[model samples]
Target: MSTPLDIASLIDRERIRPFQWTIFLLCFATTLFDGFDTQAIAYTGPAIVAAFNLAPGDLAPILIAGTLGMTIGAMTLGLVGDRVGRRPALLGGVALFSIASLATAFASGTSQILVLRFIAGLGMGGCTPVLLALAAEYGPARHRGAIMTGVLLGLPAGAMLGGLLAARMMPVIGWEGVFVIGGAAPLALLVLLWFALPESLHFLVTRAGNDQHAVRHVLARIVTWPLADDARFAVHEAAARASVAALFREGNARNTVAIWAVYFFNWIAWFMFLSWLPTVLKASGLPAAQAPLGTVVVNAVFIVCAIPLSIALPRISTRRLLIALLALGIAIAIGLAYAETSWGLVFTLAGAAGLGIGGQQIALNYLVVGAYPTTLRATATGWAIGMGRVGAIAGSAVGGTFLNMGGPGGFYLTLAVPLAAALLAVIAIRTNEPEAGTSLATAAH
Candidate 1:
């Protein structure tokens, strides 16, 4: 008695639903937690120093501990996220970071807090790359660019939240309360995920060898489940037989290295700016009290630019877009060397830097999802990020050293080197996807 239209509606109700909003919320909450976790350490730095009667030198180990832990986490969990399922990998990351953060609240000594923060850093590292992979999987083809940007911008938003929280409550709650807040938020998210967060259908289909029930549920929520052949999907027909080694064969090797290079340089430059920017500002004549506010300006522009930047990306070629943005970033950083006391001039140059960096980040997220099969998606993304973490550590350390030696020119020049490499990497990089496309991940309901 049912017409084809009726059958189509039924399929939509049960299969291949566009995953636009569902994926967005899933990623938004996770990115918020990411921002909160990363910023907590800086916010707590002062209180910890005072409480422990610590010298600035004494704090270096604590900072290094987290970076070391994060490096390990990125490599280990990242590999696992690729081998296992992204959903489980992501959940595991959240759990590890959340528990580690909570553990910090109870620590009575610097040594104890160092271990806890390191543990949290590992988890934080695991989350970002894996989460990026997951966001790409659930999102619609056209919407991938915007969704990734929307989700990643949450990181800056989270950082801002930590700053606001510290400003308001550090007096009352101190460092312990700040970490408790960061730790507890994800615990709440874990519950919400259990009830509503669905496994990414793309991951299920490509990585888990397909499940009609899950795939259908996710799809049906969209206008209807797709009833297409295997070719419509990027998943290989031979994927069941394909190991990750397949990605390294002649067809994919150059692409892999280029991607890795891009990630490494990108993070080095990014962390250099983030870790050193305020210090650089202070040296440029801003009061110490006001120097930290420069981060607010940088991140504010970054978060604001994310939406428009991402919306624009899908329309352009990925390689072209990424290389162009990185180039612009390099130019802006050079310009900052000349920007002294002109607040308006400085902010404009700073925002230009944010624009370039923000665009590059969004493009990277897009590449993480679309460039590989769902099975290796998390792993590839994770490894790239892990390399970046290493660069961040080096960048932070070197930026500090540079600041000590000279001034703004010295600081900005240090960042310029890595960024130049990133630009070159972008040029060499090629994705499996064609030049350009669009997607706005959607659900039928």
Candidate 2:
């Protein structure tokens, strides 16, 4: 009998190669565009409101529409990724969002803008979980956390890009022009992804086993040596198809519940801040032109801290790290309540919150990846984040209401409550000691 080809071992033992970097960069690009389109509405909210003669509260429907689409997409499209393949699902998401963004430029009224944002959000929500799954599968077990963390950096990077682009282009191209640029750039990158990006090797060797040649081809690209023609490959999962319900089975119930709770609480607070911070800054006497810089500062520090923190996560206890970060987040929220008195203090709190809460956000994502078998990794991630989108929708809706109430202090204070709840959820979660080598193949069993 031929020895079974253990792909998990191959990736774990082999030296990191250029192909892995290529995969990481491609996923990074997908996330970058996802972030850009998601935040485009926020960055251009003032302009969109001015153009339509609307109040800040009116923007809530548009924000909630996109997040609602995200909720739907994360569950449905995420199931598509698990049932079909990550590459196609990812591409489909990119196409949907790109087209919706282009359509947003021509929206004539609130309803039209709301519909287009909902469509774009479907794609945005679907892309992120698939990207995280792919990054975990492609990266060496030792470095998977860092690679996925790096991939997620694209989110804040895209936000930073949106802020800078809006500041520069709103003058020349108008808000519609910003959407046009965001739409156009991603469409171009979509072409690059079609040609250059490979499907997840783990998915191929495991999920698409009927196509043996394709599996060998992808393996050859990542493996340092050539594969033998007769080499047999196998993933340890049972023959039954993976499904969302599987996440609740197989000793995963507690983990699934905890993961969803964390995502929901964290995103609720995070999106509320993300969606309205610029307007709040503007209300606090920052120049219309400069209000976005507060968000820019927050995103910059988030990306910077996220990169190094993810690299260090493999060496530390993720739960402890998360608790510490959430505590810091609470402290920052308190400071933010008092920050309206000074732009200097506001900027300082924003940057510090980015470092604390931002790192916790990324760490929670990494924890989710490790909590499930590979067969259901994408499904579990999608559902966790999908449910979290509900919280995000609530955040956007509530932020609008809070803004209407006319006090920045209350908005900041409300956000702290969710952060504290999420911290407690982390403290309550229990799991088998995390596997040191969390490869897709090993994770599947």
Candidate 3:
């Protein structure tokens, strides 16, 4: 008789195959568009302000609405993936956001923009944790850090692309044209996703009364050879019922809280940079035309730093690495406080901030994904991201205040406190590495 299959072990032990890479690519594409939708408002802020006859502070509600919507989606739709399956939840999110993006172009007033952005936020926010979970689940345990980090890179990549595109297009087509492009590309992608993306085999195996044959079929694509029809599959998790409450059960409460605290604090500073950087750069004496350069420089450097940092993560201690990144961020923020009109110095400091703050947030995602069992993975990621959205909202709102009150120097100085708090949170969380000598098969059981 053929040996029964342990699904988690089979995945963990196997080298990554084409199909798994395909899934990662699909998830990456989703996130790329997500980044575009999320940051497009910031890119168009000046145009919007001029069109609407508003002050810099007026944009705060628009910025906060998107993230607040994200908070709700992360908390709610994140669970939908677990209840139904990742494929459907992801597809739904993509469609929702794409449609909302198109509608945002036609927005007539602040009320319409706020409502539409919230709607778009629901889709974009919901997709992130699901994609993160999919990437983590499909990736081999040995290289999970690299795989998930690779997916995380999609966000910055999209941001940089949007920056470039917005720069080129805004001169000709105006800000509304940017939204049209953002909305349309993903809608075209949706068809590809419908055909190309496969459901997570790990999720299938974990489902109660799951179709073992279906799991076997998906596995056949992942493994080198066909499985016998009679082979059994299993995902090892304690039989505690799966629910949101389970996130707080069995000592998970501490881990969940730590993850939330890290995301919340880190995002406060990060979004402050994203939502306000261009305006601040302009105020700091960079030419009005060149302000967008600052935003692009930060995103470009972030993309460059994230790849190497992710690759090195498997070799170094995650907690220590994150703490170091946060410390570097604090130091960079101080430098930025003093940076003046020399565009060269401003760009350099922005890049450093990217390396410090942006890199730490990516590493934090890796930690959150690794902290939970398969059952609660999506929910845990969503909740942590949700809590972070609260910070993002605060950052967006406070950004206006910073610009109005202290200017760039005061704003940069304020970032240090949050970075320090996030560092402390990283120190407080325990690393949940696989126990020594515990093989994938043994650990799953």
Please list the residue runs of candidate 1 whose C-alpha ends up more than 4 Å from where it truly belongs after superposition.
1-23, 43-60, 78-88, 133-137, 168-173, 199-259, 278-292, 317-324, 335-348, 364-386, 407-409, 424-433, 438-445
Candidate 1 on 125-238: residue-level lDDT in tens? Answer: 778767776776655444555566678788888876776676667678877897898999998997776667766555666577756556655555664435444312234232
Reference-based TM-score, model 2:
0.86
lDDT of 2 by residue, 1-445 (tens): 6988777778878877898888899999988988888888888887887789887778999999998887777777867988789999999999999999999999889899999999999999889878887887777877765676678889899989988888777877888998998899999999999998888666776678656688777778778877888986665554554677787896888888888999889888888988888777766667666766767888899988876776666556678888899899999988888877688888899989897666676677556656765667656765776667788889888887887785788778887999999998887777444555453223433
For each candidate, the alpha-carbon lDDT, in order, equals 0.69, 0.81, 0.80
* Candidate 1 TM-score over all chains jointly: 0.73
TM-score of 3: 0.85
Misplaced by over 4 Å in model 2 are 202-209, 238-261, 365-386, 423-445
Specify the poorest-scoring 10-residue window by lDDT in model 3: 436-445
Clashes of each: 24, 0, 0
Q: Each model's TM-score, in the order given? A: 0.73, 0.86, 0.85
* Candidate ranking (lDDT, best to worst): 2, 3, 1
